[model samples]
Target: MKTQDQAAQGKVALVGAGPGDPELLTLKAVKAIFRADVLLVDDLVNPDILDHARFGARIIHVGKRGGCQSTPQEFIERLMIAEARAGHFVVRLKGGDPFIFGRGGEERAHLLDAGIEVDIINGISSGLAAPSSIGIPLTHRDWSQGAVFVTGHGKTADANPDWDALAKLGMTLVIYMGVARCREIQQALLAGGKPASTPVAVVHAATSGSQAQLITTLGDLPAALTESRLASPSIIVIGDVVRCASQDLFHRLTAEPDRIAG
Candidate 1:
């Protein structure tokens, strides 16, 4: 296989920068960053992660906020093709795992169609990081033996989703990038037969030095967030395993009552 340094004309590395903290990056990801001639980073890709890049790396920031001046998806595809076509080692760096929510799939498909060699590197997802940051274990032998991940902003925004056997899955529920519509999700879950009192944890800026967790019941999701003042981009976890959080691995990463989110 040609290494990133080989500088092949039609090769791209889809690298996940992890949650936020620079320290969380894997060694392989760092190596990719160092070898890349151009970096296409997401809006949420932490600046600290970019410090690992080689000097003079061409950095291209692609906007991806809820209500920001964002680059069109097609335009980004073209950018990747153009950069990779130029024989530059291109690293497409996304905040979370590239395959999770990032449009890495679309980009990969496009690149593959063009016959560009693409390498995908997995990174810790905020979906996992957020729960761990707040001491919430997504699964427990007693509480839950499985887990499910869902996006809060996708379809079924207003309508009740007929969750297919999810209620009996005995799995912890996790919602990523879903703070604004969390209440609806909670309601849907409850309507689907999930207990109203299921424990819920809202973790903000998870896995970073600055992290905040809000403990609440599934029934009180909207109220809890409104009172706690946590906003979008935060991870939402729901299940009974959260009851053990304070003494778990995320104990040290938990933030104080007032957290600086930005």
Candidate 2:
């Protein structure tokens, strides 16, 4: 019995586009995009996702691209604030899970401060999705129990990741924005007494057609990754779980004679 007028009041939804794969999007997120009156998105988000917006909504691009002059975060928040104030439902879309370096926290705080009704729609993060697609488990009783997600691409002033702790902890290490620092990080971990032969898996353009998963050892990770010509938006995973993905894929690929070379 709700009136159409009552339903038209503005609301804001922060949506996660997932790590470049449209298939990885959650159903709720898909529904929210389709319902949006205005969609504000980031550059990392894949283009295919826009097909889900069935409402013929206005799509606004306010994304922060790597190495580019990013549109100020405060400006993006104000855009959301201004649009929602006009009584249009706005969707702030980001690539990957919103909470994981997606900058959703800032926007959330801004909207709430302005007294706008807001909600977050979670999506798959590349951290876990990339490895899983390559058939790696993050934890194993026999290998390692903890999994650490770190950002390796940001400013040195903010944090050059704690190489010392990561080296000693037996956790599965998942690093984002790692391409730039791959060599340095690998060397640091190697210097910290982490086995030079420890397995490492680098997933590039994960969960998409351009995807490539390369398995190598920590010592050779830098060379292997560089040789493969993989680009940004990739993830680097180190630990025994690297073997898990390789073994799983090997068994599966080996089991299928059709896939094997004659």
Best lDDT goes to which candidate? 2
User: TM-score for all predictions?
Assistant: 0.87, 0.87
Tens digits of per-residue lDDT for model 1 on 69-100? 88888988888888888888899999889998
82-170: candidate 2 lDDT, tens digit per residue = 88878898999998888887878877888898878899999899898888888888888889888999988665655678887799998
Worst 10-residue lDDT window for candidate 2 reads 253-262
lDDT of each: 0.78, 0.82
- Model 2 earns a TM-score of 0.87
For model 1, the run of ten residues with the poorest summed lDDT: 253-262
